[model samples]
Every structure is written in structure tokens, then in C-alpha cells.
Target: MPKRIMFTMGDIACAEGAISAGCRYFGGYPITPATEIAEWMARRMPEVGGAYVQYEDEIASITSVIGASWTGTKAMTATSGPGVSLMMEAVGLAVMTETPLVLVNIMRGGPSTGQPTRGQQGDVMQAKWGSHGDYQIIALTPASVQEMFDETIRAFNLSERYRVPVFLLADETVGHMRERLVIPDEKDIKLEYRKLPTVDPSEYLPFKPDDDLVPPMALLGTKYQFYATGLTHDERGYPSDKEEVQIELITRLNNKILKNADKIVEVEEFMLDDAEIAVIAYGTPSRSAKRAIKDVRQEGIRAGLLRLKTVWPFPERHVVDLATKVKQIIVAEQNLGQIYYMVKAAASPTPVHLMTKPAGMPQLPQEIVQMIREVHSS
Candidate 1:
């Protein structure tokens, strides 16, 4: 009710944040690193007059959340890489139907459950491309326990406002680590709900977009009687087979987010005012990069960090702007180099270098500082 402060793990904080954001339904399957989210939801949902259902598998869990959302409930699910694999088809379904929901991914070492107890950032690209199709989704990478609490609430608000699935991407390191979290008072927190249709049920068009290119959603069990499907549909929510209809529908789906990227993207810059070498990182690796930058700064290296809080709209504008001022950009991630290519593409001819770590390992700050030194000398 009032401001609550405590030391908590990221996963537990995520569950509490969802409750704070007014989420009333949670449907998920337990998996490594992310299981605590479901466990906490199971215990807390009933206490909050909400429902938590543990389905047979991740596919059912995702689909259940989709169904619960149509009933005018703020619904979400949590999973890891393997569970995400099973939810891809339904992810596409949520996209086609324009369902507003949240998907929290507490990533573990993977490629087939590579290391359940270990952490990794290997799911960066998967969050963007796990589901097939030309679609856009918002993904947030929280670097600390405090961020885990704060970003989960933001994820729900974005999903509701945009009518798209938002991903809260965290790895095992962040998910399991305990740290201080401050929960603001209820009245102080900002919340957003889906825009409901103003028109009568007889005149409702479920897929009709306003000027913002986002449709006003009508709830199930209401006077509004409309159809929805994974198939390409017209503004009236009826199935359409025309090529023009396909293009029109798909284009709007992608553009709603892409056109708004400037507003949705968030990046934090540290010591970049006159830096010659820049570092870009996100999630757990961003923590390491911050420390690395501080170490290099003490050694007379003009280095800074560009930490990504919103990973999906990819923050190309920031990267491009950084390239104009910095001599080189170094990308550090706990993967084979997924985001490195993205940085290289955005900062072309700006000499982007990468420092990578394999799964089950941390990107040490000392190693990152060494890389900065090498780039400074070269």
C-alpha cells in the first residue's frame, strides 16, 4: 500500500512489480531461472484477488495468458529459452490478434538447456526473432534488482498502450541476485490501461485503428461481438485472402511500434561528454561495462558506457550519434556477439569492436578494461 523497501531477488521483485502494476492474471510453466517468478505469482495472486494458473507446458501457459487478456485482465507469463521455443507459434498468434500481454524471459545458458543453473545473454536476438514474421515487439533489459522491479511495471504499461507483447529480458545472474528494492507508494506509480472502444457494440470494428494506428480493444463477454484470428483480417476482424489486405494489416502491425520507437527507446549514458572510446552493453554485461569504464577512467582513458535499457527498438539513433563523437565503439555481451553486429551496422566505419563471453560466465570488468586499453593504443 505505502512505500515498501526490502532486499529481494530480481525474480521475486518482478512478481511483486506485476502485482503493483495491477496484473490480475498470471499463467506460466516453471523453468530454470524464471521459476521463482511463477512461484511468487502463485503465492501472491490469490492474496490480491487475482488468478495464477500453472499449465501443462509453456504453450498452454502462453495461450492461457492470451485468453485471460481478452477478458479485460492484465495477464502475463514467465519462461526461459526452451519454454520460449514452445511459445513461438502462440507469440505469432498474439501478434496477429494484437493481444496486449507481458512475457518475462529470465534467460539461462541454452541451445537446448545448455546450463540450467547458469546465466547467459544468448536470448537477445531470440526475443526479437523467436517468432516468425515481420513484427515488432518491445523488450527491456534491466541491469539490477531495482531495475527488475521498475522495468516489469514499465513492460506492462507499454504492452497495454501499444497492444503488443512486451518482453522483460533478464538473465540468471540478475534474476537470482539479491539487492535492495524500493517500492513507491501506489498513488505515485504511473499506470496505463488499454483504450476501450467508445462506439456501440453494433458499430464496433475490433481492428479499426485510430490516428495513432492502435485500435481500441473491446473485452470479451461484453456487448461487443467481434471476431479475431491469427489469419490476416480486415478492420472488421474478418478473415481476408486478398494480397492488399495482407500488406495493409502486416504493415500497420510493424509500424505501430517502429513509428513510435523514438519515444519507446531508452538508453543511459555515463561519462560520454568527451570520451574517445565508447562501450555499449545491456543486461548483465552492462553492469560489467560500467565497472570497466570506471576502471579505465581512473587510468586516464576517456571511456564511457552506453547502457541499453530498452533493447528492442535497438536504439540505433543513440549508436549512430555516439559514432560521430567517439573514435571507436566496443560492444560487450555474454554471448557469441549478437548485438555486436547490430552496433557495427548502426555505427558503420566508426570501428566497432566486440568483447564476448561464453555461457555460464560473466564478462569480467578487468577484461573489458583491457580491451579498452588495447583499442586506445591501437
Candidate 2:
């Protein structure tokens, strides 16, 4: 049996998870709700032969992680809303250059540091489309400290497997809550390393897509002499202003993720087989959703809960399937209908209701049960 350990906050579990995942480089600036993640990494990195550097700002911090990743090191960074805003450009750079890195955003109130220490899921949409471009980003939301450890490890593995930056999206409550987590042994977990070029340096093409749709990566100090840029480029990594090359490059970038979305999307279902009403939620709100479902079930509502572990690359197929079976779908999120819209779009013709509270506090179980009662009455 696995031993269960208690954690005071989710950020500590995230730090422990990254370290266990073989992350050796951490570059970040201090920010509220997420500052503890950096502090934990700083204190623990040296003990694990890793390095932690507090950058001058968020932009530099994210850029430094990208640079470290390009040098064949597993790198990560953590920040809050305002800091994530500052790191958007560097995130775009990571996408364009195909840098495999993990970014943890312990979300607080947004729109210019609205509430630095308060909880909010307002960054859900931002994580998907924060950067200025047409690209696919993987974002995972954890509802508990146990998930903070498991999901952070998954984020790094997905980043390395897909050659893209991955987001570990957590809010203040989930980032700060204490829970008993079962830490896995090192030998049981499988870690995916980046694929290196098998051909000689002279014949290597940096951006050449392989059979797996992921291009082989070459480290900066390696014998391979190839260039990398953000602009639309060919397989040789040279910038091209041609419309055809631009189209192909952008299409490949988007499809590489979309085509393999089944391997990326993850969710947890509870008592869904015979449920008449279903609750859709993610992050901290999902915890309330789970409890609310139990409350409604005790009241003989035949309700179930669908908790999203992967927020981005939305689980449309699963949502549609559940919608077809359930009479009503209730979406409870910290934000005011960000993911609710996607759920509605996927479950067309099925009545979808929203139970949202964006006041920097998580939705309560009673609040969700009340919404379900209102829906059933109507």
C-alpha cells in the first residue's frame, strides 16, 4: 500500500512533484498565491542537485526557463495572474520554438492584480488564448493538493511528449489547501524525455516532423547547427514570408495538438451511469461540485459530477455523450461562464445552467445544490 502524506498547501506538493519529475531548472519571480511555490523550489532544488534562480521580473523568469529547456534541461516556473500576464510573450516564444517546459499559474484575482492573495478561476480562458497566435496549448486544472502533485508531473510529461509548453492551472484555494497525498515511488512512474535526432549533425533538420508528429529537438550546445525563430519557418528553421509556408507551419502547429487530443484530454466521472442531472466543473469549484452531487443524490436527484483535470482541448465528446443522457447540465466554476459556454456549445439542445461566482472565493456546495434544485423545479 502507498503511504499517504499530508501537505499544508498545494504549492508545496507542486514543488515536490516537479522535483520528482526530474525538473532541474526553476526560474521565477515572487507573486502572491504562487510565491510559496517558488520558495519551496528554491529550498528544495539544491538538495536535489537542481538550480533555482529568482529573476528580475516575470518576463525574464519565463524566458530563462525557455532558454534552459532549449539546453536539454527539464525546466519549470510558477506565478500568479499579473505575473502570468507579463509572461505571455515568452509563452508565445516557447510555443513557436517548440520548447518543452512546465508553467504553473496559481491563479488569484486578475485584470491587473485585482486581488493578489484571493482565489479565482478567472484565468481559464486566458490560459487557452492568452498568447497572441493561432496555436494549441495544454492546460490542466487541479482541484486538490493530491492533484497538485499528480497533475504537475503529468504536465511535464505531456510537455516533453508533445514538444510544447504545458500549463498547470490552480487557484488560491487549491494551491493553499492541505490534503493527504499518496506520493508514488520513483520506479513506478514513467517519465518521457525529449526525442533527439538519430541522424548525423550534418544531415539534421531541426523542425522536421517525425512519424509521431513531434519534431526532434536539438540542444543548444549540440553538434547540430540549425537556427530557431518565431516567424513562420520551413523544416530548416529559416524564416519565410511565403503564404504557403506560413499556412503549412501554422496548420502543423495546430494539428499536432488537435490530432493527438485524445491522448491529452483527461477527466474524472462520479456516478454518471444512471444520472439524470450532471454537474460540470473544474479547479476548486469541482470540489464543491463533487460534494454537491452527493448532497443532491441523498435528496434522490440522481445527480453525478464530471470533474475536469485537463481544461484545455476541451472534452467535447464526453460532454456531448453525458448531455445526451442527462436531462440538465449544471456548470459550476469560479468564473462567470467561461467554461460554461464551451459546455453549452458541446451540449446543444440540452439545457445547460451556470452556477458561477467570480468574487475570489470558491463556490459552496450548498450554492450548487440550490442551483440544481432551481433547475429541477423549472
Candidate 2: tens digits of C-alpha lDDT, residues 187-279 = 776788999888999889899899777899999998888899988889999999999988888888888888888899999999898998899
The true-structure Cα RMSD of candidate 2 reads 1.5
**Over the stretch 149-267, how does candidate 1's per-residue lDDT look in tens digits?**
89999999999999999999998899999999999999999999999999988999999999888999999999999899999999999999999999999999999999999988999
Residue 80 lDDT (model 2): 91
Q: Cα lDDT of all candidates, in order? A: 0.93, 0.90
Query: TM-score for every candidate vs. truth?
Result: 0.99, 0.98
Task: List residue ranges in candidate 2 displaced over 4 A.
Answer: 1-4
TM-score of 2: 0.98
Candidates' RMSD to native: 0.8, 1.5
TM-score of 1: 0.99
Off by over 4 Å in 1: none
